[model samples]
Target: MFDRLRLMSDYEAPTPVWAPASVGAFVLSPTHLDHLGLDETLRTRLLRWQQYFDDHHPADLCGWDSPGSSQRYASEGEQLREELERALPGLRVELDLWPVPADD
Candidate 1:
């Protein structure tokens, strides 16, 4: 089993990306779901989370402009973290919040 799994949203895109806690450079997107060592049930959950994130957040940076955007993002991240923990007990799950946008 992987030591750690991190869930994060990047500026390049709002989609959630999962990576090892020790390594941020190597990430697994939702599409790369082939022999990932994760069982089909977990893989399906991860993909569902990705799709949910993509659907709720804007694909570009403009998403930050909307009111309560930060809170919304954090809420989703928290939910994902909870899901990860429930699905993989004892696994370290980190939710890396993106930089907060400046108030206009």
Candidate 2:
């Protein structure tokens, strides 16, 4: 169940928890999920995340900007962040860039 963790660069303080960045893969802790900036209470969101990930998986995002520019990736990342924050307390995973269900 905990297989799709995206390993990110070493965090100075922020515990890396399946970041969308193209770094590495790592598992997430209850505390780490809370740090993702969810609106629900940390405790509630943690449980929600655990159950949510059980069936669904987050997908990386890559948006397109202008005719051909690097802005798309940046844009996509921002959107993903917003979705992650807004989709708290629910397993909807609004921030998945390339959302692919774990069962899939």
Candidate 3:
């Protein structure tokens, strides 16, 4: 699905896990907008992710501080959200940043 999206749109597939953080940093930078020629909708989605991160404190899936983990998770989550929106237009969706455990 990800590869297909990359082939169809301006979106680029994310790098491998072991790839350098600098690569991810570059992708998150505003310069990518000009380089990739992203549409306003995609740019808006990216900005929304930035706002979400700014408004919420980082938390782990287990609701504990795992240092850098939360930021990484949020970045990946935002990427997935953007990809989904691109793949499925007009699909209303809501995301809970602080989700409760299934046993709760």
Model 3 clash pairs are none
Candidate 1 residue 4 Cα shift, in angstroms, is 0.7
The RMSD of every model to the true structure, in order and in angstroms, is 4.3, 13.2, 10.2
Per-prediction TM-score: 0.60, 0.28, 0.36
After superposition, candidate 1 runs with Cα above 4 Å error: 12-15, 21-24, 31-63, 101-104
Question: Could you give candidate 1's per-residue lDDT for residues 5-60 as a string of tens digits?
Answer: 77775533423556674665456655543534456766665565555445555566
Off by over 4 Å in 2: 1-17, 52-104
TM-score computed on alpha carbons, candidate 1 = 0.60
Q: Name the candidate that leads on TM-score.
A: 1
lDDT (0-100) at residue 94 of candidate 3?
30
For candidate 1, the 10 contiguous residues with the lowest summed lDDT are 9-18
lDDT of each: 0.60, 0.38, 0.39
Q: Which tens-of-lDDT digit does each residue in 1-104 have in candidate 3?
A: 11212111112322111112334322234554434455666656655544434333333323424435455545555575556555446542233334223332
Pick the winner on lDDT between candidates 2 and 3.
3
Candidate 2 matches the true fold with a TM-score of 0.28
Identify the leading candidate in terms of lDDT.
1
Q: What is the lDDT of residue 4 in candidate 3?
A: 18
lDDT, candidate 3, at 75? 53
**Residue 29 lDDT in candidate 3:** 45
